[model samples]
Target: MAVALSRRTVAKNALSQLGTFALSGGSKAIAAIMVARTLGPKGMGTFSLSWTLAGTLAFVAVLGLDNRLIRELARTRDPRELERSLPLACLLGLIFGGLLTGIPALTGVHSDAAQALAAAGGFVAVSAPILIFRATFHAREKMEYETVTCVVEGAVALIAVAVALGAGFGVGGAMLGLTAGRVANLILCLVLYRRLWGPVRIEIAARRWLGLIHEGWPLAVSYSLTATFLRFDILVLAIFHPSAEVGMYGAASVILLTAPLVAVSFSSSLYPILAQAEGLDDEHLQSVFQKTSRILIVAALPLATGLTVLATPIAEMLFGSDFGHTGRYLALLAWILPFRFVNHLFGVVLAATHRARSRRLAAVALALIANLALNLMLIPTWGAYGAVAATIATELVIAGLLLAGIRPLRPILARPLVEGALVALAMTGVVLVTPGGIFPQLATGGASFAGGLWVLFLWLPSRGLAAFSATEQESAAAA
Candidate 1:
C-alpha cells in the first residue's frame, strides 16, 4: 500500500512534468520561429549555435552533482547532509560555470553574437544552481514546484523574445530576453527552495561535495555527450551551409525534438522512484521499468507516424513559407522519436541500477563521437537532409547499443514492442487514408493508437482494482 502511494505519486508528477514540457516546447517553438524569421537563416544559425554552446557548457558546470543529490535524497530523508552539500554544488557550479561560460563568449565569437551568447552563458551559470534546488522537489516527487517554475520561465522568455524582436533587436535581442527569463527562473527557484528548507547555510562541505562529484561525473559526462549528440548536427550544418539553410534545419529540428522532450520528462518523473528500488528491490524496478518502456514505445509510434505523415504541412504552417523544406527534414527526422524514446527509457534503467556512470559514459561517448563524425561526413554533401540522416543513423546506433546492453529487458520488451509496432502500423494506415487536414489526420492517428492500447492493456490482475492500478500494485508486490 505504501508502495502504491509512491507509484501514484510518480504518475501524478509525470503528468505535471508533461504539462511543463508542453509549455516549454510551445514557448521554444514560438521563440525559434520568431527569431528565425526575424533574423533570417544566417542570423538564426548564429543564435542557435551560441545557444547550443551555452547548453553544452552548462552541463560541464554541473559535473553531474544534481543526479547524485537527487538519488541520495530519494534514498534517505536526511536534510542536514543534503543541505550542506547542495550549496556546495551551486557554488562550485557558479565558479566553474562563470569562467567557462564567459570566456568563450567574450573571446571566441564576433560582436553581436558574442554579446548575446555571453549573456546567455551567464544565464546558464545562474541556472545551474536551480537544477540542484529543483532536484530536492523531484526527490520528494513534488514536481508541481518545478512545473510552475518552468511555466514562469517559458512565459517570461516568450514575452521577452517577442518584445525584443518587435523592438528590432533581432536574434541577439532575443538571446538577451532568454537570459532575462533564466534570471526569473533562478529567483523563483531560490524563493521556493527557501520556503521548503529555510535559509541556505552552506559551509564549504569539501569532502562531501567532492564525493558527489566523483560519483556523479559519469552522469555529467553522459549528459554532455548526449546533448552534443543532438546539437552537433546544427553546429556542423552551420559550418557547411548558409544561414537560411541553418534556419530551415533549426525549424525542422525544433518540431522533431518536442516528442523526445516528452519522453525525457516522463523518465525524469520516474527517476527518484526507480532510484529508491535500484539494487534493493529489482523486481519492482524491473516491472515499473518495463511498464514505462511500453508506454513510451506505444506513445512514440503514433507520434512518429503522425509527424512523418504531416511534417510538411505542419512545418509550413508553423514556420511560414520562408522555411519551405522544413517538412522534408522533419519527415526524415521523425524516425528519431521512437528510437530516442526507447533509448531514453533504457538510459533511465541503467541509471537506476547504479551502473549508469560507466556504461552510459562509454555508450554516449561513442554516440557523440559518431554523431559528430557523421555530421561532418554527411552535412558537407547532403546539407540539412544529410544532417537529418546523420541524426537518424546516430540514434539508431545508440538505441541498438542500449538494447544490446539491457539483456534483462529483452523478454519484457519483445511483446509490447511488437504490439506497439502493429498498432502504429494500423494507426499509420488510418492516418494515410483519412485525408482532410493536419488536425483530422492527427486526431485519427492518435486516437487509433491510444484506443487500441487501452483495450490491449485494460485487464486487471488480482487486485480487482483498475488494470493500471492493479499492474502497479502487482509490480510493487513482486518487489
Candidate 2:
C-alpha cells in the first residue's frame, strides 16, 4: 500500500506540475505570440535577444544552489538555514542584474534594443528570490504552492504585456510587462512562504553565504555551462545575422523551447523523491529511474513526432503569415524533443545519487565547447539553422554521455521506443489527409495517436509501459 501510495504521490505531483505548466506556460506562449505578431520579425528579434541575455544571466545568478538547497532542505527543513540562503540569493540576483544591464551599453547595440535589455535586468532581480521560494515548497513536497505562484506570474505577465503592446510601448514595454509579472511572482512566493512556513528573517550571514557558494560552485559551473550552451547560440546568431532573421528563429524557439516544460515539470516532481531515496540500493534506484524514463520517453515521442509533422501549420497558426518560414525551423527543432526530454531525468538521477559534479559536468562542459565551436563556424554562414544544428547536436551529446555515465541503469525502453515511432508514423498519416485548419488537423492527429496506443495495448497487453508496471511494486516489496 505504501508503494502504491508513493507512486500515486509522484503521479499527483507530476500532474499538478504539468497542469501548472499548461496554465502558466500557455499564457507565456500566448504572450510570445502577441509580441511576435505586434512587433513583427525585427522587433521580435530584439525581444528574443534581450530575453535570452536576461534569462541566461538570471540562470547564472542561481549559482547552482536551487537543487542543492532542495536536497538540503529535504534533509532538514529548518527555517533558519533558509533565512541565511534567501538574502544571498537576492544579492546574487542584484549583482547579475547589474551585469546584464551593463552588457547592452558596452556592446553598443541599437538604442531600442539596449533599452529593452536594460529593462530585462529588472526581471533578473525580481526573478532570483522566487527560485528560493520554489525550492522551499519543492522540499516539503507541497508543489501546489509553486503552482499557484507560477500561474499568477504567467497571468500577470500576459496581461501586462498585452496592455503595454496595446499602448504601443513596443519592445521596451514588453520587457517592462515581463518584469512586472516576475515582481508579482516574487510577492506571491513570499506570501505563500510566510503563510505556510511563517515569515523568514533576512539576515546577512556572510560566512554561511560563502560556504554555501563554495559548496554549490561546482554545480554552478555545470549549470552555467548548460545554460550558456543552450542559449549562447542566440547571442552568437544575433552577432552574425539580421534581427529579422533572428526573430524568425526566435518565433520557432518560442514553441520549441516551451515544449520542454513538460519534461521539466515531470523531472522536478521526481527529483525530491529521488533525493529522499538516498540510502536505497542501486537496484531499487535503477528501477525507479528506468520507470520514470520510460514514462517521459512515451510522452515525448508523440509530441515530437506530431510537431515535426505539423510544424508549418502550427507556426503559421500561432505566429501568422509573417513567420511562415518559422515552420521549417520548427520542423527540424522538433526532433530534439526526445533527447531533451530524457536528458532532464539524467541530471536528476546524477544529482540525487550525489554525483552532481561527476562525469555529468564533464559531459556538459564538452558539449558547451562543441556548441561554441559549432556556432562560431556555422552561424557565420548558415545563420539560424547553424544554431539549430548546434543545439540539437549538443542535446544528443549530453544525453548519450550522461546515459553512459549512469551505468547498469539503462532507462531506454526498446519496445516502447519502436512502438511509439510506429504509432507516431500512423498519426502523421492521418493528420495529413484529414485537415481543414490547424485545429481540426490537431484534433484528428491526437485522436488517431490515442487510438493507435489503445490498439497496441489491446494486442500486446504485457508490452511497452505495462512491462515495467511491477518496478514500483517490487521496490515497495523490497522496502
Candidate 3:
C-alpha cells in the first residue's frame, strides 16, 4: 500500500511538471513572437544575450544547493530542518548573485545604461531567495503547489511583458516588467511555503554548508560547463554574425529545444521517486529505469521526427517569413532530441544513484572538448549552420559518453532508437508524397505522425505507461 501510494505521488508530480512545461512553453512562445516583432532582430539579440548572461549568473548563485537540499530533505523528511536551512541557502544565493553582477559590471560587458544590466542583475540577486523557497516546495513533494506557482509566474511574466510593451517601454520596459513579475512570484512562493510549512527557522552552520557544497559542487561544475558549451554559440554569433542571424538561430533553437522539455519534465519528477526507491533491489531499479527510458524514447522520437519533417512550415507559421531560414536550423536540431532524451535518462539515473561525481566528470570532459572543437571547426566557416552542427555533435558526444557510463540503460535505449528511425522513415515518406503547399504538407504530415504514434503505442509495450493500466499482465508482473 505504501509503495502504491508513493508511485501515485510520483505520477501526480510528473503530471504537474508536464503541465508547467506546457503552460510555460506556450506562454514563452507567444511572448517571444511578440518581442521579436516589437524589437526587431538587433533588440532581440541584445535581450537574448543579457538573459543568457543572467541565467548563467543565476546558476552560479544557486551553486546546486537547491538540488542538494531536495535530495537531503527527501531522506530526512524533517520540515523543521528544511525550514531552518532555507534562509541560509537564500543568503548564499544572494551573495553569489551580487558577485556575479558586480564582476560583469566592472568588466563593462553591459555598458549601456538603457540596457538596464544593473537592474537585471539586482533582479537576479533577489531571485535566489525565491528559488530557494521554491525548492522547499519540491523537497516536500508539494508538486501541485509547485505547478500552480509555475503557472502563475509564467502568466504574470507574459502579461507584464505585453502590458509593458503596450505602454511604450520597448525592450527596457519588458525587462523591468519581467523582473518585477519574478519578484512578485518570489514573494508569493515564500508566503505560501511559510503558510504550509510554518515559519522556516533561519540558521547558518559551517558543517551544513560544507555538506551541501560537497554534494552540490560537482553538479554546479557540470552544469556550468554544459551551459557554457550550449550557450556560447549565441555569444559567438552576437560577436561574429549579424543580429538577424542570431535572431534566426534563437528562433529555431527556441522551437527545436521545446522537444527536450517533455523529457526534462519526466526526468525531474522521476528523480526524487527513484532516489526514494533506492532501498529496492537492483533488478527492480533496473526494471523501472528501463520502463521510463522506453516511454521517453517513444514519446520524444515521433515529435522530433515530425518537427524535423515540418520544420520549414512550422517556423514560417510561428515567426512569419522574417524567419524563413530558421526552418533549416530547426530540422538540423531535431536529430539531437532522441540522443538528448536518452542521455537525460542516464543522467537522472546516475544522480539518483548518488553517482553525481562520475556523471559530472563525464559531462565536464565532453563540454570542454565539444566547446573547443566545435568553436574552432564550425563558427569560422558555416556561421549559424556551423554552430547548429556543432551543437548536434556536442550533444551526441555527451549522450554517447553518458550512455557508456550506464551499461544497464543501453538495451532500453536501443528499442527507442529503432522506433525513432521507423517514425522518421514514415515522416520522410509523407513529406515526399505530400504537395508543396504548407497546408497540404501540414495535414498529411500531421496525420502520418499521429498514425505512427498510434502504431508505436499499440505495438510497443512500454513499461512506463504500463502503470496506467491494471490488467492481467501487470498483475502477473507485480505478483
Give the CA lDDT, 0 to 100, for residue 410 in model 1.
51
Error of 1 at 408 (Å): 2.6
Per residue, candidate 3 scores C-alpha lDDT tens digits across 1-479 of: 01332567767878887776666566556666776777766656666666556656666666776666677777776775565456666776677656545754577664432354555675577667766676677777776776776677777878888998888776656666667667767777877887877875767665677766676777667666766776777778777888788878888777755668778778778766666654323565677777778877876777777777788888888777778788998988888887778777777777666644565467657766876688767876788898898888888778777777765445455767787678767876887788777788778877877777777776444654565575767788989
Better of 1 and 2 by lDDT: 2
The order of the candidates by TM-score, greatest first, is 2, 1, 3
Q: Candidate 1's residue-wise lDDT over 279-308, tens digit each?
A: 523677667777788878877776787788
Clashes of each: 3, 0, 0
TM-score per model over all chains? 0.88, 0.91, 0.86
Best by lDDT: 2
lDDT of each: 0.76, 0.82, 0.70
**Can you tell me which runs of candidate 2 are displaced by over 4 Å?**
1-5, 103-110, 279-281, 450-479
**For model 1, what is the C-alpha lDDT against the true structure?**
0.76
